[model samples]
Target: MKMMYLRRLFTQELCPVTHTDLMGCLQHSPQQLQQLLSGGFAGAPGLESLSWLHNLAPCFPLRGDQIQVIHEPQHFYQTLMQRIRQAKKRVVLASLYLGTGQLENAFVQTLRHSLQAQSSLRLNVLLDFTRGTRGVANSKTMLLPLVREFGEQVQFSLYHTPDLRGMTKRLAPPRWNELLGLQHMKVYLFDDAVIISGANLSNDYFTNRQDRYILIEDKPLADFYAQLIERVQEFSLAVSADATEGLHRNWRILPYEGTKEQFIRLAKERVTNFVQEAYQRQLQRQELDTEADTWVFPLLEMGQIGIHHDSVVTKQLLSNCIAGSRLKLATGYFNLTQEYMDTITHKCLAQCSILMAHPNANGFQGAKGPAGGIPAAYTLIAKSFYESLVRRQQNHRVNFFEYQKPGWTYHAKGLWYYLPNARLPNLTLIGSSNFGERSVNRDLETQVCLVTDNMDLSQRLQAEADRLYDLSTTAERDIVQRQVPRWVQAVVRIFRNFF
Candidate 1:
């Protein structure tokens, strides 16, 4: 009940009322609140001073870092390969799955050459067990060959996030737990440089699909990400080259502690401790990095919602939406939580635009058919969500868009917020997070919240935003409503949370 009250209070309904106007009752104006949060309200009086929640929030910012945004997959892959080859001391790579394909083979061959060239170099590859163990159609095992060659030269680990699905476990087939619960984060770190992306190491992601990419060259930031991998590695299982005993031995088999909720809470605590420690370490190292002029806040939402309950990314996003004077967001998927939807329709903003993937622009559209496959189903469901927003009473206040490009799939995801009277976005997020229920309540997500006072950086980000808007087609309500079949809308309504 207390939590429920807090949610309502934060909503800030603007309709004139008697005693129900919470903000009015508290004598707090939204403008004043925005001022308090424009630069992140930390160390303030009351609830702001609490360390437990403050540590989790992306409230603090780090400065003096060179940042670059990469969108072209071919260019991204080439740059990544270059970084891998140039590594000196250590290279840490983590992805949900290092997919099987020519792309994966290239990466493997590169690692081999790097190891041969430099004997002392350290390489650590972490992956989600459920995904890493799987093979593509008519392909050999993904990681085993690499493990065989590297042996103990390279470290291989699998993050097997415990599955306490209980009765729901029966709903899925064999290996259901693997599919349902996963470590969805994607990170790439090499020495003092890091490439943060939502894209997986696959040919499709490399050649056709589009995903947000941000490169930061700062050892302090690199150390933080590397440490995150190390901490997860501590909890993860180490894979071996032996196929016989390796399968059974690589996964950590922790017994059920209590309810799934209890176990998730414990896991959240562990993750939070690591994050707090990394943040403190970065703070200490910040003094030495003199070139960092832009502020970067690492945002993490690392657990299941009902079970673990650290919606740091979601909460911070909501705060930004309510606080920012203008907002621009791009996401491949269109599904949105009620809170987000409300924020979009209600924010006291001068301008707002949302870019989403068109039905044809879906990465899996080629695999989908009229009879309906996973890709077709998801696109249909997303259209329904888009329709809902189009029909909103405040729809006129926002502009909707879908990217248009032949033979290319849209996978971009990020948010940009402009402060009042500012020409460029003062705050932005870039990484693996998508704006949807799965990202908000289910998946393990990571994003770097970049807040900058540097005018040059803001101008560059504005140019990116302009390009995104320019490449998109303005979504018309009439056109969308006519295209989607009514039956699909019903289905979307029934299973809205998954998207």
Candidate 2:
């Protein structure tokens, strides 16, 4: 009965083309679509068999050899430094904020030297305004020296969310203000190569914090993200060193040239239009690489500014998971949006496994005050989700695991999809989203859905997923609930969306 329902759902809602028409529309053959519709595609149906997703976003084709999955934090840092040092054309970095640490200082020095060496090289950086200017000495202060040295060649923008305005903005404290919203996309671009990661430019991210990173050496893909960041900087605040201050070295901030309403409205229209036009261009392209074994679909979610391509694509992907599908999802923060949880438990028939941080492994494990209870709050959220699964008798189909390394904190967040009875994942989502409410409704997030038919890339992706899963232990609801305080549970019940 479920299979019949899924088939009907696919045909009625997802199928936009007949078999013959689909052959011309998708990179896949019509036989693959037939197999997917009939539930008989070899061992299992891979993402390549899904034609709807390809149609929903702009698809860029590239070879599997162009991609590299970096597993360790140290390697990610080293690769980033090396790429920055070698960059000759341009370097663009977008992160939540830059950390004031030795490693970060070194990173900035490397950029300075790169700029000193190549006069033609340009650098563009985008960071959240609230978080960047949080303390007396912060990310803004760290970058002002570079601006003073290089002027327009070294430009940075601080994005301020229009959500936290008026009385709330004044009353909100320093560390807590970031909970309202943030600029959370993390993209590091150097010349024609780009590294997409959830890790920030911090000492913890460079040392023991666990996260995912994917390096793609493709010019078109790099240019796409570069342009996307440029669009975001259009509405952000610019930083310039004050020449009149001279020895004082004072810096000035030039705010967006309009009211908050105007900024929000104009930024939304420009970003949404840019994405739609890119999608249309991809759809109309007649020279796409038909023989390419790998394709990338970029998903952008800026719900605060009203752009939600990522959310729409993610919901559709989850809702269309038929029987025999396997999905592995990891989020360091375990607060799944209610809609996502409902679709996984009640709508989808895929066998799903969720990996989240154990209380001991949470980044906020040993913090002070209410911030320290964050681990417990996440436990409460997970308990609620677990109860929902039990009520629907879906706990058997979906399992939970907690990642707890001895001395490390877990911050990895993404999704990996495996075809039934398959040992490897054919598709993966990697980026800065934790799938929490804040990601959905507050922050700006971006992730890419990578669909590959190349066996080598598939193997590498599966290995990355396996490594994380190997360190995780099965989560028991009662055990997790025992650690949650009553007060924490009450807090979670009241302000569930903020986390």
TM-score for each candidate, following the candidate numbering: 0.78, 0.89
lDDT of 1 by residue, 180-236 (tens): 556667789988988888887888788988787878887777888887777667556
In model 1, what lDDT does residue 449 have? 73
Instruction: Kindly list the per-residue Cα lDDT of model 2 for residues 66-174, writing each as its tens digit.
Output: 9999999999999999999999999999999999999999999999999999999999999998899988878988888999999879878888787777777789899
| Runs in model 1 lying further than 4 Å from the true structure | 1-65, 136-140, 164-179, 244-252, 255-265, 281-292, 305-314, 320-324, 347-350, 368-392
- Cα RMSD, model 2: 6.2
Q: Estimate the overall C-alpha local distance difference test score of candidate 2.
A: 0.81
Which window of ten consecutive residues has the lowest lDDT sum in model 2? 243-252
Ten-residue region with minimum lDDT total, candidate 1: 13-22
Clashes of 1: 3
**Candidate 2: stretches off by over 4 Å:** 1-48, 243-259, 477-481
Pairs of colliding residues, candidate 1? 64-292, 64-293, 65-292
